[model samples]
Target: WVQKSLDVTFEEAVALRQAYLHRYGTTLGGLTAEHQVDVDDYLAFVHDIPIERYVRPNPRLAAMLSAIPLCKAVFTNATSEHAWRVLRALDVADRLEWVVGIREVDFNNKPRLEAYQRLLAFLHAQGPDCILVEDRVVNLRPGKRLGMTTVLVDATPEEEVDFAVGDVLEVGPLVARLLEAQND
Candidate 1:
C-alpha cells in the first residue's frame, strides 16, 4: 500500500519510509509534505487490521489502570480508532479518559512541538503537570524538554528519561512515587 501510495518501488518505499521517519518523525507527515497524499484515505487503509488476532485481553493491565485515581489517556501518533481497538482488545477501553491521536492534533504527530503543545492545550495542562511514559527514547525527548516527567517503559533509561521500568506494569509504582514526591 505504501509503495503504491508513494508511487515508489519496493526498495524505494523502504528507503523513503526510513528517511521520512528520520526527517519527519512520521511517514505520513513526509508524505503529505512531499506528495499530494490524501491523509484520511492513507490512514484508513494502513490501520485496517485484525487487532484481536495479535492482541489478547490483559485483565491485569486493565485492573491496574482502573486503580489509578487520575484521568488517563492514550496519546499516540496512530489514529484514534486504531487506539480504541487496541484498548478494547486489552479490555481497558473504559479505563482511559481519552485517546489523543494524530487527528486530534490536526495531524501533528509526536516529536513535533505542535503535537505536544496541542496535547497540553487539550488536557489544560502544563508540561510539568504530566508524566510521559513511552517505550521509545525519541518520543520521550520532546516531553522531557517540555518538563514532563519521562518514564521509559523499557529497562534501559537514557539521560532524558527520569525513571526506568522493565515493563509498563511497573509504571504504576513509579507514577505513585512521582505523585508522592509532588505532594511533599
Candidate 2:
C-alpha cells in the first residue's frame, strides 16, 4: 500500500506507523481507526517488501564488528523473523550477540524510549556505552537519548548525528581510532 502511495517514502511509512502508535496506542490500532485497513493486510504488505535487493553483506563490516571486543546487538523495528532473515542473508547472523525486534520486545519500536530500555535490559547492559550504527537519523534519536554512542552511516546534512560517514566499510578504521583514544 505504501508503494502505491507516491507520497510515502520509507521514512514516511515508518513515521506513519509510529503515528498510529502515538494516536491509537499501536500501529494496527491506528490503521484500523483511520483507514479501516485490516491489521493482517497491513502486516502482509509490510512483510512482502523485497528486502534482499536493499541489503548486502560487507565483509569489512563483519571483520570490524568481530574485531571489537564489546558485545554487539541489533535493535530493529522489523519483526524478529524478518531481522533474522536479513541477517542470515547477509551472512552475519552469527556475529550478532543479540537481536531485539518488534515481536521480541512486544511491538514497541524505535524512537520509543521503551524499546531502547528493553534492548539494554535484554543485553544486561549498564548504560549507553555501546555504539549504535544506523542509516537513519530518526532511528538514532532514541539510541542517542539513551546515551549510546551513535554513528550515522550515510547521514544527510539535516541529521547532524554524532558521527557521519559515507560507507560502513570505513567504520573499521574509525572504531580502531576510538579504541586507541579510550586506551589513552
Per-prediction TM-score to the true structure, in the order listed: 0.95, 0.72
Q: What is candidate 2's CA lDDT for residue 33?
A: 55
lDDT of 2 by residue, 3-61 (tens): 34435778887888788767645565456556655445556677776668888876766
Clashing pairs in 1: none
* Clash count for each candidate, listed in order shown: 0, 0
Highest-TM-score candidate: 1
Local distance difference test, per candidate? 0.88, 0.72
The C-alpha stretches of model 1 lying farther than 4 A from their native spots are none
| Ten residues in sequence with the least summed lDDT for candidate 1 | 152-161
lDDT of model 1, residue 73: 86
Tens digits of per-residue lDDT for model 1 on 1-184?
Answer: 6799767799999999899899899989889878998888989888998999999999889877876778898899999899999999989999998899998999998889889889988888999988888988888888888898888986686777899899898878777777788799
Q: What is candidate 1's TM-score against the reference?
A: 0.95
Compared with the true structure, the alpha-carbon lDDT of candidate 1 equals: 0.88
Task: Tell me which residue pairs clash in candidate 2.
Answer: none
What lDDT score is found at residue 1 in candidate 2?
Answer: 63
Candidate 2 structure lDDT: 0.72
